[model samples]
Structure formats: C-alpha cells, structure tokens
Target: MGQRTVIPFGPQHPVLPEPVHLDLIIEDEKVIEAIPQLGFVHRGLEKLVQKKDYTAFVAVTERICGICSFGHSLGYSQTIEVLMSIEVPRRAEFLRVIWHELSRVHSHLLWLGLLADGFGYENLFMQCWRLRERVLDIFEATTGGRVILSACNVGGVNQDIFDEDLRGIVRVLDGMRGEFGELSKTFFRDRSVQNRLGGVGYLSKEEAQDLCIVGPFARASGVEEDIRSYGYGGYSALASFEPITSKRGDGYARCEVRAREVLQSMDIIAELVDKIPDTPLMTSVKGAPGADSIAVSRLEQPRGECFYYAKGNGTKYLERFRIRTPTSQNIAGMTKTLQGCDLADVPLNVLTIDPCISCTER
Candidate 1:
C-alpha cells in the first residue's frame, strides 16, 4: 500500500474558479476520499429578505451569484408572483427567457474557458473568453449591465429589447456559433484532452440519481432530468423543447453535455426572440402576499436546477426566503466522484461538475 497523506485543495487555488475547499485523503498519488468544506464565503443573503420588501428583494436575489444572477431574480420573482397570484405579460415572459438563456451561454462559455485553462491551454482559454465577451456585449446592449442586469421584477421585466435589436442579437450569435464550433474541436478531438477527461470520474446513472445530482452532471449520466422541459416562463411557447443528455457519465461526458448546452441555449434564445409577443414589459404589482402564504419556484440555471422558496405574512417583507442552488445539490456527487481518482485529475473531475461555490455558500 502507498503511504497516506492529506492534501487540501483550495478555498484558493490557481486553477479553481470558485472558492471551493476540499480535504482530500490520499493514498500515494490516488485520492482515497474528498471532504468538502463549506461556508467559506457565506454572506447571509437569504436573511436580507426580512429587511427588503418583496418587490425590492428582487435585487438581493439577483446578487446571489453573478453567473446565476438572472435565474435567481427570475426564480425569486416567480415565487413572489405565485404568492401574490400575479400573471405576468406574455411579452415579459419571453424577454425574461431570452435573458436567462443568454446568461446560460455566458456561463457555459466562461466555464469552457476555465476548463481550457485547467488543461494549460492558454490560447484556447483566451479564445473561449473572447467569444464570451460577445454575449456580454449583447447583455450590455439589452439591459445596460454586463453581469448584474437587475432587469427582472416581481411582476415582469423592467424593460424590453427592441425587435430590431433582438434580431441583431441573433445575428451576432450566428456569427459566434461558427467560431465556437471550431473551438470545441480541441475539447472533443485533442488526444491530450481525451486522455485527461474521457474516462475520468465515471458516475453511473444509478449513482447520479442516488446522489440526487442535477444539471449537466446528472444529464451526462443518463438521468434525463431538466427543469426547463416543464415549460415555465416563455419555455411553454417554444415549438419544441428537450433536455440535452449523454450516457457516457464520465468527465468527458460532462464536458460534452455542457458544450452542447451552449448551442442549445442559443437556439432557445433565437426561438424566444422570434416569437416574443408585443405587449407591456412591466406589470404593476400592488399589495403584499397573503398572510401565511408560501410559494416556490424552480429554474434550470446554466449549471443545473435552482430552487427558490418564499414565505409571507401579509407584509411587504417576506417572512422567510431560501434558495437551494445546484452546487449544493451536486456537492455530494463531487465527493463521490473524488473517491479513487488520481490526485492530478482531481481538478478536472471537480470542474466537470461546475461547482459554483459562491452560489452554494449563498
């Protein structure tokens, strides 16, 4: 047997994107187990609902994680909309979905860049980020902010994208699609990449379901789970919708699923932008939620399913607010995959799950 030692992998690491810490038990060069250390960046954002009114708290929810910001605001607003029985306009729904899918594209691209960097491919990393900037430009044109748009409100969106601009957005994405397709070749065909991730961190469908994994991680394992298919928001208006999935259930499969999802998001955006109705953007909200009222909403974020829960007591301020981020749900699976992995490949395995430590801590 190899000599045993304990290694700590970042709340800070050169290659890790999020501030995630793992206590790894090593038997020689192989990982025997990995234990997650949480709350490194917790800020008590959920408790802020007590001080912020239901309408005002939309901003707070959006701040949960910059990458998943739109989904947070959308889900929190949806929960409040449910609590108050507010029916948002059809146009608003479509706009919300457009922004949400764009956010997903940005997130997946950023992740792809980080993944490339993890493999020491500096040029590829920069190329991935360069493509991501175009998505950010679209956000800046539509909502006036690159990261935190703060466009979603309790009843609907705060503003609308002009029809011309929406079409322009589609054109820009069409231009980028070809570029991204060329870049993805490295991830799929490169011998180095395949050796690094192809068969690493294999998780069977049963194990994924057993761990209650969500998002690309679960989909890669053949779980066939995606919250968007439920057709919430503008998704209901789409011609057809299906979850992107793979049965490989390995590190490469996870990468493949997310890479494909980036294209899927672009298509969803194109559909919503084309079909969006001509209606009012914002619907005025009045009165607080009913006393002792509770409502919940789930959104399929870039990484996976994010759940928001809210409770009200006949007041503007929510009595309780909570969020169960995808990272939180997938942490167990991360540790599970860590078992029996080579120490050098730990980062690749961890990145495949796309751990959002900030979201999880929040």
Candidate 2:
C-alpha cells in the first residue's frame, strides 16, 4: 500500500470561487477520503428574522449569495405570501416565472463558464461569460440590479416588465441560442473536456436518490426530482415543463444537464411572456402575520432544491426563519464521490455539484 498523505484543498483555491475547504486523505494519487469544512463565510442572514419584519427580510434573504439571490428572495417571499394568504396575481405569477427562468439561464451560464475554466478552457470560459452578459443586461433593464434583484416582494413582484421589454428580452435570448449551441458542442465533444470530466465523479441513480440530491446533480444521475414540477410561482401555468435528466451520473453528465437547462429556461420564459396577462404587478400587503402561523416554501433553485421556513408570533417580526440549501444536502454525496477518486480530479468533482458556500452556510 502507498503511504498516506493529507492535503488541505481550499478555503481559497484557483478553481473554486467560494471558500469551501476540504481535507483530502490520499494514498499515492488516489483519494481515500474527504472531509469538508464549512461556515467560514456564514452571514447569519437567517438570524435577522427577529431583527427585521417579515416584509423587510426579503431583501435580507436576497443577499445570501449573488448567484442564487433571486431564488432566496423568491423562496422567502413565497413563504410570506403563504403566511399572509396573499393571492399573488396571475400577471405577477407570470412575471415571477420570467425572472426566475432568466435567473436560471444566468446561473447555468455562469456555472458553465466556471466549469470550462476548471478544465483550463479559457476561451470557452470567455465565450460562456460573454453570453451570460446578455442575461445580466436583461436583469438590469427589468429589475435595476444585475446581481441582487430587489424585485420580489411578499405578495408579488415589484417590477412589471412591459410587452416591449419582454420582446427585447426575447430578442437577446434568441441571439444567444446559436452561439450557445456552438459552445455546447465544445463541452460535449471536445476530447480534452471529455477526458477531464466524462467518467469522473460517478454518482449512481440509487446513490443520488439515497443521498436525496437536488437539481441537476440528482437529475444527471437519472433521478427525476425537480421542485419546480410541484408547480409553484409561474411554473404552474407552464403545462410543458419537465425536469431534464441524464443517465451518465458523472461530471460530464452534470455539465450536460446544466447546459441543456439554459435552453430549457429560455423556452419556459417564452411560454411565460406569450401568456403573461397585463395586470397590476404588486398586491397590497396588509396586517401582520397570524399568530403561531408557519410557512414553508420550496423551489427548484439553480443549484437544486432550496427550502425556506418562517414562523410567526402575531407580530411584525417572524419568530424564526430557516433555510435548507442544496449544497448542504449534497455535501455528503460529494464526500462519497471523492472516495476512491484521483486527487487531481477533486476540484472538478467538487465543482460538478456547484457549491455555493455562502448560501450553504447562511
């Protein structure tokens, strides 16, 4: 047997943009085990539920992470809406779907770029981010912020995208399709990318289900679990929605799943814009939450499933607010995948699950 060596992967590493630290125990070049260290960037955003009123905490939740900000905002707002029994308008629902899907597109594009960079494909990385700029531009044009979109509220969305604006967004998405298709070919067919990712980080379908993995990570393993299929927000109106899945259960499969999701999100947005009704954007929110009321909201975030729980005490402030981020749930699976893999593949394997340390710890 080869002598064992212990290595510290990162609180900061070139491949990972977040502050996830891993202790890898290896025999020669093969990793025998991995232990994760979290909480380096915990912001205590969930703890602010007591300090801020339910209405004001939506913005607080939005600051969980820049990449998944909209998902956090939506989950928190949806929880508050349930607590208050706010009937979010159809137009508002549709608008929420539009922004949500656009955020998904934006997130997937960013991840693809990061994944490309992880594989040392700099040109591919640049191309992916260049396409992502269009999505961010749409965010700025519609909601006034590219990252922390303070557009969602308790009852509904704060901004109303006009027909002209919707058309413009559509134009931008359409323009990217060809270029994105070309970029996807590189990811799917390039020998270097395939060599780096294709069979690494294998998670079988049963293993994924047993770990209760969420989002594309699970879907890549052929587990057809997507919280969006439960029909929240504007997703209920889209009859054609289906969770994308791949049977390969490896790093390449994970990449393929997200790459396809970007296109799927575009289609969903088109469906939403075509059917979005012209009506009031925001509904008036009145009264404090009912005493002893508890609200829970779950949705398919860009990462996976995200959960928000809120408890009321008959006052302006919520008694408790809790979040369950997908990365937290997937960490065990990540650790399991790390066992018996080459040390060199560790970063790419970890990136396959797409950890958001801030969101996970917050």
Write model 1 residue lDDT over 1-362, tens digit each, in one string: 98889999998898886788899999989999999898888999899888988888888888889998999899999999998999999999999999999999999999989888887889989999999999999989888999999999989999888999999999999999999999889889999888878889899999999999999999999999999999998999989888999999998898899999999999998888878889998789999999899999999999899988889999888899988999999989999999999999898888889989889988
Task: Score each candidate by Cα lDDT.
Answer: 0.91, 0.90
* Backbone atom clashes (below 3 Å) for every candidate: 0, 0
Compared with the true structure, the alpha-carbon lDDT of candidate 1 equals 0.91
Q: Per-candidate TM vs. native?
A: 0.98, 0.99
Compute the lDDT of residue 235 as modeled in candidate 1: 95
Candidate 1: give the clashing pairs. none
Candidate 1: misplaced stretches above 4 Å? Answer: none
Q: Which segments of candidate 2 are over 4 A away from where they belong? A: none
